[model samples]
Every structure is written in C-alpha cells, then in structure tokens.
Target: MNVSKLKKGVLLAAGLGTRLVPYSKEMPKEMLPIFEGLKGRVFLKPIIQKIYEQLYDAGVREFCFIVGRGKRAIEDHFTPDWAFVEYLERNGKEEYSSLLREFYSKVESSYIAWVNQPVPRGTAHAVYMAKTFVGDDFFFAAAADNVFIGENVPQKLAELHEKRSTPILAVKRVNDPRKYGIIIGREIEDRIYEVEGIVEKPKTPISNLANTSLYVFPPEIFKAIEETKPSVRGEIEITDSIQILLSREIKFLAYESQADWVDTGTWETFFRAIALSLKHSGGHNIVFDVLEALREK
Candidate 1:
C-alpha cells in the first residue's frame, strides 16, 4: 500500500478529562493553556490546533476531529470568522486581519469534519467513530493531550509510513515505564523498535520506550477494533486491538521522536509543558526582565 495515498488525520479529543477537574470543569482539556507570557497576557493555543498545524505541514489536507458533547469549543475554534476578520481590516488592523484571513483560507482548504464521541469511550472507540470518514486506506492519529513538537515530526512520520507501507507508532524513551504503555522489542537500529509487544501500564515493564499516542493506522484497524471486546474497565482498549493485529503478523513499527513529549493530562506535566513553551517563546527572558523591573520599583 502506498502511504502517500493516505492523507487523512484523526485527532482524538473527546475524553472527559476527569484527572484535570476544577480546571477542566469549564474548559476542555484540549483548550488548556500550556504557555503564558510575563506581560500578564496568556499565549495559549488549543492542543488540537498545534496537532492540526503539524498534520497540515505533513501534507495531510483532511482531518476528522473526534469530539464529545461539551467539545463545541473545539469546533468553534476551527470555524472561520470572516466577519470578524473583515472588521479587523476596517479598523486599520490590516496586518492582523490578513493573518486571520490566511488562517481561514487554510481552514477552508483543509477538509475538517467533526465526529461526535457521545460516550466517554476509550481511544479505540473514539478512533472507530472516524472509520466511515477514513474509508479503505491508511490514516494518521494523534491524541490531543500529547503534543509532538519538532521541525517536521509529522512529515517524517508520513515519509516513514510511505516507505514501510505499514502502521507506524510514535514512541519516546522515558525513565519510568510503568506510567505509560511500554513497547518491548529488539532495537533494530538507534531509536527504532521492532515492537514485539506493547504492555499498557505494566507493573514491571520490559522496556522504557513508551507509546506517545501517535499512530499511522491502516483500514484493517477498523476491523480489529470491531472484533475487540471491552476490557475489565468497560472501555475498548486500542492497544488490545493493535495486539491482535500484531498477532496476525501485521507490522507495527515504533518510530522514536527526538523532540520532547509533553503530557498535559496532569498538573505536573501541564506546568512542565507551560515552562517549555515559555522557554521556546522567549518568555523566559521576559520573566527575568519583569523581575528586574519589579526589583527596581
């Protein structure tokens, strides 16, 4: 199968996010602020937007956003605001207006369709909801909570998928394997795992390579998901389905990313992501400048 033919990407953002409650009580977890500036202004962008931008850069022109009932904000953010954009232009903000217009133009070009995940099902169920949209081909999948940052991680993943013509799962080496889905396998090369098995949250993990919620799946995955039964937790596990596929001699390649994996599902990881983003945004220096100004006061 030619992976170049696979052009669709699915973003899973329908989780209830019970872990980040109080904060997530009003806003979707995907909308959480991962960065802020010292100017008292927040430089926050939805997780989905960042993932979408990466996919767009990877030649993925179509997207299916799997959202739940309270995820209207996700849809609204992607929707074009032509009227407001024109208003900005009329008020002598042509630069800002043009930027927004260009953004809307890209949104229009990108075929973005929203699929509802009414129930708080597992990742497999959320992905299965987009099967009809995927048709008979391979597609990309990324969790909204995990942001992959690099020069061209998405494009590189797409290139690998096209070369191998198989499902490619993104992974990162972590010191603590028990906290994530650990991928156990022989290292064929540096940072490349053959993926003999994937153990989700294992007490005694065999490897430190944790699955980072990025995947390139073929259409057969939909069948595997259909055959999958709900686990003891009453949620259909995507890993179980992928294991079934692996048992059938299907190839699951593990591609390691050099970029940092920021998991924003918890308070600690969320703050870490904010700090990293701030450092990248030149806001760290701004913080010191603000501190100096306050001391001079």
Candidate 2:
C-alpha cells in the first residue's frame, strides 16, 4: 500500500458556533483572532489563517474550505487585499504589511475552493462534501477553529502515514477524556497507537488519548462517510464513519502529539487561546497592556 504524500487539504468551517453567542453570531467562529507577533510587532490573526498557514507549511497546496451560510467572511478574509497591503506600506507599517503580503503570496499560489454546506451538518457530512475536491488523493482534514500550538502535528502525521499506510488521527493525551472523542488502542510504538475503536464523549472512562479533529485520510474515507448513517442527534458523526471503517477491518492509526491543542469555540477557551498565542509570541505582557487599555477605554 503506497500512500503518497498528502497534497490536498480540507478545512471544515461550516459549523454554527452556538457555544460562542454574540461574538460568533455574525462572524464564523473560525474567524476569531488570536495573538501573533514577530520582530517587536504584536498583532492578531484569525485562527483559520494560522491553520491554513500551518497546513501550507506542511506541504498541502490544493485546498477546499467547507463553508456554510454567513461564512462569506472567511472567503473575504482569505482573498488577498493588495491594496490594503500597499496602504500599510505607504503608512510606514512595513512590518505589518509584510506579514499580510506573505499570507497573500501563499493564497495566490494555492488552489482554494469554497464549497457551501448550506445547512449545518456534522463533520462527516462536511468532509463528504469535499469528495470531488479531494479526488483520489489522500488528503489532510482539520477543523478550522483549532490551532495545535506546539510541534507540527500535520507534518508528523503525514510522515507517520507514509510509513504506516493507514488512516491517521492526530490524538492528544488529556486529563479528562470524557469531553472529547476518545480512542481505545494498543500502542504500536512510542506516541503511536493502532486504533481499535473510538468512543465519542464516553460516559465510562476510557483511555486518555483524545481525537484532535486533524486527520490524514485516504479517499476511501469519503465512501465510509457515505455508508455512515445519522446518529441520534440527526448529525452524521465522523466517529460513526470511523467505526464503519473499523468494522470493515480497515486499520487506523492514532498519533498522540505533544502539541498544545487550543480550541477557540467557546468564550473561555477563546480567551485562553489568545493567552496561549501571546505566550507563544513571548509577549505575555501585552495581554496585561491590552487589559489596561481596555480598562481605560
């Protein structure tokens, strides 16, 4: 089984962010900004942008963004605004303009498509919508609202897939596994597991390995998702799709990473993501400065 290096990428950003109310009411939650700074300039970028950049850095070029209604903001944001970059340059904000310019360069060089979901569905359905976009190639898929903050899980996952030639799930060890889709597997090697089963938000405690919603899946996953039926919640869960493949004796592997997974879906986690990003930029003091400025305002 020869699995070539993944080139196509799919980003699921179509979910309605009910957990985040007013802030996400108008804007997609994936558009929420997180701290990013370089060379004495502290700034913020949408988490989706960060995710895209990470995937781009990992060698993914052809891209598809699964979007739903009220997600025009995502498309607009991904569009390169050379005029804005030029305006910043004219204003002597070269550092800031350079960042945008770099992002724009990536955007221009890639093949990006926006596929509308119209009605919000679960992750399985969102991924199924990209079947044509992915074609026969193995591709990387991720939830756009998340940013894995440490080591490059995407790069590692791809490398793992090259050797194992199986579907790969980026897993992480957490204290509480009840909230996430937990994996039951046997360790084949250090930080790698041969996945036996997956339990979504299990009541009875399972393993600490939690699915991180980042995957390197073969095109067969689309077929698995197609065979998957809707769950009790009337949503086509990706966990169910994985179970389908498992029952068919298809091997899946989980990569437990050291990356700090930051989920910016709710108010609490959103702010926590900001703090974590600030820390990553070595600008932890900027958080206090922003707070003081807000206090004065």
Task: Output the number of the lDDT-best candidate.
Answer: 2
Per-residue lDDT tens digits for candidate 1, residues 118-137, read: 89779899999999999997
The TM-scores of all predictions, comma-separated, are 0.90, 0.94
How displaced is residue 114 in candidate 1, in Å? 1.1
Lowest summed lDDT across 10 adjacent residues in model 1 is found at 34-43
Q: After superposition, how far is residue 199 of candidate 2 from its true place, in Å?
A: 1.2
lDDT of 2 at 158: 76
Residues 72-103, candidate 2, lDDT per residue (tens digit)?
99999999999999999999998889999999
